[model samples]
Target: MDEMQLRSKIILTDRFDETFEQLKERFSEALFYHISADDFLVEHAKEVVDRAYLTSDREKVIVLSAKRFTPIAQNKLLKILEEPPSKTHFILMTSTKAGLLTTIRSRLPVVDMTSSKEEIQLTINLETLDLAQLFSFLQANRRIDAKEAALLTEALAKEAMRSGKYRLDEALLETFAESIRLLDMGSPPHFVLTRLCLKLLERKI
Candidate 1:
């Protein structure tokens, strides 16, 4: 990677720890500030913004790794991301890109580091999604916890897009992002899954 490539960017990867370690090694010479969390909340976003604003003559890289980023947190950091401080770079590492808001996605270029060969096998096909199938799928995964729910939501979004059978627009994409936010906020996994599937069904082509 060249000096220009080391600038602020979003990195999509399931293996957060490994990807982060590689980045640390790559930016070995620069000052580094890592703020990692299972769920990045508003406070973490504030910390990132604070660290970014600190004057730095040398290259400073702020690595933010999280399984999920709340909408509020992402929004709060939008301004700083759009116009970063001098010699400051940001590397956002996350498990999936579905949860990221369009505003944040637009500000930073995404570098896909995910190497998972396993395809997402969805129980209810988004292309042929119906009420009965949706109910059946929900019932089957009724015991799913929050973390699993987040992963499932990501898979569903991915499968829906890959199927190319839905009228995917910004509104539909935001629903998927909101589903993740709901799950992170302790909402029932089944409920989130139900709402997401229903939204997809509504937009099916």
Candidate 2:
């Protein structure tokens, strides 16, 4: 592995397989061990740690891709990430950074691989969000599934920040994070979105 490919890092992308393939191409010569899941749990983390400890003279890359990573799983992997085995590198790929714990994020550099084209186009203007607009937006997206809802939630949060129209204190920021979690846990998309928008409306500057 070269200088750029030596360290463990997080790759943020909605297209996990595509990004994983790109990483494989980048490190063609290295031995690749991929562990992909919709949700990375503690068992998966144990498998990764086990793979990391395996004796290997050549470069070994463990690619762990998931839609969401549980806090317990992330906590389990922290020690090895901080001090990985010789010639072992980890690449964590996820749809949204909100699902990751700060401790896990602090351990590795995050590279956003998502293109502008992949970002959700927000229909509702968060800056000028009124009750009528909010209700209309909700009605328009009443049938949104969890996956789309997650993307929309992220887009809305970004738009709110970019517009500079909200008093985004830590609590407000945490609401966004919690919204993502609720979506992942199979909460009704419309309900989660409605709650988030109301909170944002209340915090408008």
Candidate 3:
């Protein structure tokens, strides 16, 4: 699914898979288990790029999703993302970007993804929910990092702008700026989101 993105400058989120489903038809599937640097001996760790543990660049990239491991393992995969081999592209599919270490998040660009039509329509068609509704979903979906939440929030803000009546972008920007501040202070996302929701609802009226 991602092979197409490799051809040029493209940021890949899970949606990339949809874009390349047909293109990747014949590409062999190569999967790998998460091997923590601490768990694998130094000697074995050095050999990880080899076939037994890791697949060659010609095959599909190593996918590290939130289901199998913690943020730490994704951090471990940073070495590969940092200095990717000629044909290797690593993909991380996690609900929360908050889980990833800052250094790791910095290395990757957030691919702006079009949220599901359900979400788009929900935000557009439904008039009951306000700006805070989107933030709530951002909180649940972006557990990995503040930046992930921020990225998705920002993307959705753009969507909000396109949707007609709400002053969503400004409301969101203000709310998230505070959210990031709390995040920097080591506050949990729920706490930060709570604060953000209050700010949003205050202005939503």
Clash number for candidate 2: 0
Per-model CA lDDT versus the true structure: 0.83, 0.83, 0.44
Model 1 has an lDDT value of 0.83
**Residue by residue across 170-195, what tens digits does model 2's lDDT show?**
56766777788788789999999889
Tens-digit lDDT track for model 3 on 64-96?
333122334444555766776666655444333
Pairs of colliding residues, candidate 3? 96-142, 96-143, 96-144, 97-144, 97-145, 98-143, 98-144, 98-145, 99-144
Model 2 residue 41 CA deviation in Å: 0.4
Which 10-residue span in candidate 3 carries the lowest summed lDDT? 117-126
Model 2, 83: alpha-carbon shift in Å? Answer: 1.0
TM-score for candidate 3: 0.37
- Assess every candidate by TM-score: 0.73, 0.69, 0.37
TM-score of structure candidate 1: 0.73
lDDT per residue for candidate 1 within 95-134, as digits (tens), equals 6888677688888888888886455467776777888998
- After superposition, the stretches of candidate 1 with alpha carbons farther than 4 Å from their true spots are 1-4, 123-133, 136-151, 159-192, 199-205
Q: What is the lDDT of candidate 2?
A: 0.83
Candidates arranged by lDDT, highest first: 2, 1, 3
True-structure lDDT of candidate 3: 0.44
